[model samples]
Target: MGFSTEFNSICKFKSARELEDLFEYGKTKMRKSGFRIYPTGMKVIAFDPENRAVAIVQIKASIAEIDFQDREITLVEMDLVRPLTPEESAVETALAYEMFFRDHESN
Candidate 1:
């Protein structure tokens, strides 16, 4: 199965190079996980490996306009809030574990 989520705001990175740099920064800050680009190539999600935090970015069509341009990376507009608390992570982890086991059992 696949996962889906709804975002209220969009972030426009100047170019793919800029997006890559942002992913690298997230990897270093989280220390355990990196970023994930969706198959559609329109969204990117970064999260802490331990489930402590998550940041999702939806690329705007304007990206295509600058796809070949070189420019500095910037988080044009972001609405994602702070990282999750330990308790929140715990609950999410539990639910994820349950789903994994249940899915595997049926298989």
Candidate 2:
């Protein structure tokens, strides 16, 4: 099947305050920094104790395929990075995906 040209939404677990601010302006920032490694960027569907708020991220079409298909090869924070296990990293996104769908279905 053909794929979507851009991401419509991303699931993130935000602090109540963070969520409030996002909705306040109807806009949010998704930088390539502070999370998984994306040579360009990634839209996370994350809901661990740390992630925050639902976001709609638009990945550039040039990199979307890899961003969508690749896993973190390194954990990133600011300019610092550390190695990661691909299989291990999947859990958070997997869990987040489940939560996203569950929430969607209930609505």
Candidate 3:
């Protein structure tokens, strides 16, 4: 009749892969259609696990990596390997940036 704590409750996550798996699923559990990763300088290079080209993700943030504590945010320069889309616009499925902005939000 009720859910269990171990399924969704917070606990000691043993490894990065485990956490990444959780994050991948976290996308669906989200109620908001949009998310903002502020301090845009903190954005890092990452890819979808399924190799799906999730483009124009309307104010959504893409996470390439994470650390639970002893965190550090730094900029790394790199050239763009390829474009998200050839037309410099979003696809129908990828219409992006509709969410309200917030300053204190954290990933």
Candidate 4:
């Protein structure tokens, strides 16, 4: 039997390099912010500090053996099931811009 999950994918990358590029771009653009991951073995959600953009990844919990507490899981072994939606992207962008300006203003 197969289980079903619901999530939205705004874009899909064919390779790890592409995903890495996107992550790098966000890091450089956002500046002083980083991504956080919440893994529950079956599902993983990654987002920025401001919680503007989020990426949800679903894994085959039945077949995969994962140690939830072990934070060393390899991304290559897991699958990227979904991406941020248009609205999520917009929110993230806006938050990032706000944070950037706020940081500079405080200096």
C-alpha RMSD for every candidate: 10.9, 14.1, 15.4, 12.0
| Angstrom error at residue 79, model 3 | 3.3
Q: For candidate 2, what is the lDDT?
A: 0.35
Ranking by lDDT: 4, 2, 1, 3
The residue pairs that clash in candidate 1, if any, are none
TM-score-best of 1 and 2:
1
Model 3 C-alpha lDDT versus the unseen true structure: 0.26
Q: In candidate 1, what residue range of length 10 has the lowest lDDT sum?
A: 27-36
Clashes of 3: 3
Error of 4 at 84 (Å): 2.0
- Ranking of predictions according to TM-score: 1, 4, 2, 3
State which candidate, 1 or 2, has the greater lDDT.
2
Which of 2 and 3 is ahead in lDDT? 2
What are the per-residue Cα lDDT tens digits for candidate 4 across 24-82?
Answer: 44311111111212232454444444433456444332222234663322232234456
lDDT of 3 by residue, 1-107 (tens): 22122121112222345335434543211111122122222322222322223222221332322235433322112222232453432331132222211221242
Candidate 4 stretches with Cα past 4 Å from truth are 1-42, 45-54, 59-76, 92-107
Off by over 4 Å in 1: 1-47, 50-79, 101-107
Question: Best candidate, TM-score-wise?
Answer: 1
RMSD of 2: 14.1
How much lDDT does each candidate structure score? 0.34, 0.35, 0.26, 0.38
Q: Write the per-residue lDDT of candidate 1 for residues 1-104, one digit (tens) a residue.
A: 22232241223232445445545553221110112222233554333333222446434322111223443222232223334466765665456446443453
lDDT of 2 by residue, 1-107 (tens): 23232232343333454344444654333322122423235443323224432333322222222344453222221111221245534654556447554565432
Q: Estimated TM-score per prediction?
A: 0.29, 0.26, 0.19, 0.28
